[model samples]
Target chain A: MKYKDYYKILGVEKSASADDIKKAYRKLAHKYHPDVSKEADAEAQFKEVGEAYETLKNPEKRAAYDQLGSFQPGQDFRPPPDWGGQFGAGQHFSEDADFSDFLHGLMGGRFSQKHGGATMPIPGEDFEVAARITLEQAASGSEIEIKLSVHEPDAQGFPRRVPCSIKARIAKGATQGQRLRVPGKGGKGLNGGRDGDLYLKIELAPHRLYRVQDHDLYVDLPLAPWEAVLGATVEVPTLSGRVRLKVPPGTQAGQQLRLAHRGLPKPHKGEGDLYAIAQIVVPAKVSERESALYQQLAEGSDFKPRSHFDLEVADEH
Target chain B: MNIEISEAVWLDRAGVISMSELAQLSGLSEAILLQLIEYEVLPPAASAAGGPTFTGDCLVTARMACRLQSDFELDAAGLALVLSLLDRIRGLEAEVRGLQAQAPRRPHKA
Candidate 1:
């Protein structure tokens, strides 16, 4: 594991007070929070800062950590003598961070268990936020704004809305219900606790052309009776917009035509499929001539919508 | 590499869920979550000390199960299959995100 410099992470002096450490953490936290930052390592660095703040903000932990002497960035390190004695010697340390092995060895395991429910403890327990995007956004991926309530102003001020701009990545098959985590935009940690994370659950609005089911995209292609009875090339809508599709003769309603690898495309996995379901459209209000033509057709072949069921019932008897 | 380092980790994930949290999070009665478990549509959560505890995955699975039951009126088995398929699809998406992130980001032309 990489050695963490708590003081440096918190941006404070070695002799800084707990209050000073906390103040520094809050400032850095607001800046590097993944929901707000576009920096490459912002999320990972935020977690690191949060872990640092968690260790240093408490007096007992800080005192013990200080006793261990300075942590040289590239040097071999070890815990101070009698590390557990510092814990609970006075106040209960808040659950400000999820500490690391080094801290746990130095501060003890009590930090993890006792600190629970101290950070960002809300009645809802979890906050769920979703974003609705167009098909285009999902196809090309997008950077979008999702507003999250990071804080409710105290008696001293107005309630403020923390606008979080996140670069949303469209999953190869991210149809809907796909979620991404933006660290540190959630409810504020309690008693000077580390802030919870912000979740971006995606919901794609229904498209006019394609209906997505998992990795598959579905489209209903309307065909004339002749097209259904005799195969022909017809225009259809896809995620890529209009494309021509072949309609086989004697195609039935609910009969699906598969387009391999024409749907959702994954990174490593093979692409998903597009299914075109055939629907035979007959004019509800036909002209006299059209009605006469239909009448002539009706006089021709025998078709039963529920033939199988009739056979089963008669066989049972 | 997908180490579940914390509880809040599941707050964002759909299928990952805790046992007691499953019903409460989805605004569904306990009976409902239990029914999902009974039907085997929803995978039962992990247990500690003989008591049932769930992982983060259950939350999304339960929410999806509820939506399926309500929206499309699908039965338990159908909901399970659909949710499983959805989870697999999500897995594919995560893979794509990883590739995109690594896809040689270029500095714009000056």
Candidate 2:
């Protein structure tokens, strides 16, 4: 097992007073708390700090840890041969104790008793995983299989992470950032305690054809310049399927053509709208006859796109 | 490989869980949960036939409160203050995410 320097973890001196140790722990805990901290590994850092404080805060555990002598963190070492004999050797640690093997060897049965009596019922630890699904899956419910590495104790009562697989059905109308609770799927409870729950945070993967804003869906509807000037019926894609939409004459660029009740499904309500934003596309290449026709139209028509610019310049002057 | 079909509930739905269920799921005592409710750290979504019911988000908050209470030996009032601050931070983070999503994406300069 690797040696861990508890004092170094808490950033306190080996001879620091209990109050100083506590103050250090509080500061670190505040900085590294998973919910509060934005650090990428805040949860892991918080657990390490908590484990260090768990041992150092107690008088007996600290004394016992001190007797083992200091070593470099992560240096491979085992407890002294007589170490178990000195501490409570015959006592068994709790199956749910998640402390490091080093602390488990040093503290013995004292830690288990402090948490709750060995026979006392302790609930299992909850697990959370962020699951990403496609927009179609959110529109229509889908089944997903999730593999989780759950921390469990071996037959000898040593902590180990065992791989667990679970299959869950995400209900339809589930929105992005929704939390789905799977009961009795988390860590196993101890001493007849209730099993913990698993929380799956639903994330919608970006779609190639659509952009989602809440339940609304947006898609770029490319139209020919003539089609924008003349009315036409165009086929639009919805989550369910394709539908024919009427594009009115004189449709401008960036205009949203709303198709009601065609977007994502909302729980306990009607579906959201699908908006097709108009984009007029001009032909990049044309035949000689088409170029001549365009030139004739350009000379015949007195359309001025820069009229707004001229007006703004005149106003400024 | 064998597949185990699990029972799941959406947390955002109103009145999904009771106070007792929340207490059990959070590994906190009912009395402690009551104290948190009294301090408004966890406000129930609605009152059910049996008692007040909470949304799924309360479970996360309740678990956090349990840990903070044990780790820092904080009272209900202190936990309330900390929880309120955490809620504000989450709100600000969500607002920032929304704003970023609305902002136009610009190509990075090499």
By DockQ, the best candidate is: 2
Score chain B of each candidate by TM-score. Answer: 0.62, 0.82
Write one digit per residue (lDDT tens) for candidate 1, span A1-317.
23467888787889887779778877886567654455888777887877777678677777776776776654554444454445533322223222264365335432233343234333322345677887667665555665453433322222223444334344444556655555555555444555555556778787766766555667666667788888899887776767778887789766888887777654335666888777777655778998898888889869777899999999999
Model 1: how far residue A287 lies from native, Å: 3.6
Can you write out model 2's per-residue Cα lDDT over B41-87, one digit (the tens) per residue?
78888888888899878987888888888888888889889999988
Candidate 2 scores an fnat of 0.50
Angstrom error at residue B94, model 2: 4.3
How do all models score by TM-score? 0.44, 0.80
| lDDT of each residue in A1-317, candidate 2, tens digit only | 67789999999999999999999999998899876788889988998998899898999889878877878997766555565445544434444343375365446532333233477766787888888899999898889889987766555554555678999998777767777789888877777877888888888998877777667777778888778989789999899899999999999877889999998897556787888888787777888998999899899989887899999999999
lDDT of 1 by residue, B1-110 (tens): 22222212323323444566566555556776766677665665565664465655566566556645653445666666766776687688766753442232222122
Question: What is the lDDT of every predicted structure here?
Answer: 0.59, 0.78
Stretches of candidate 1 off by over 4 Å are A1-127, A152-172, A187-195, A300-317, B1-110
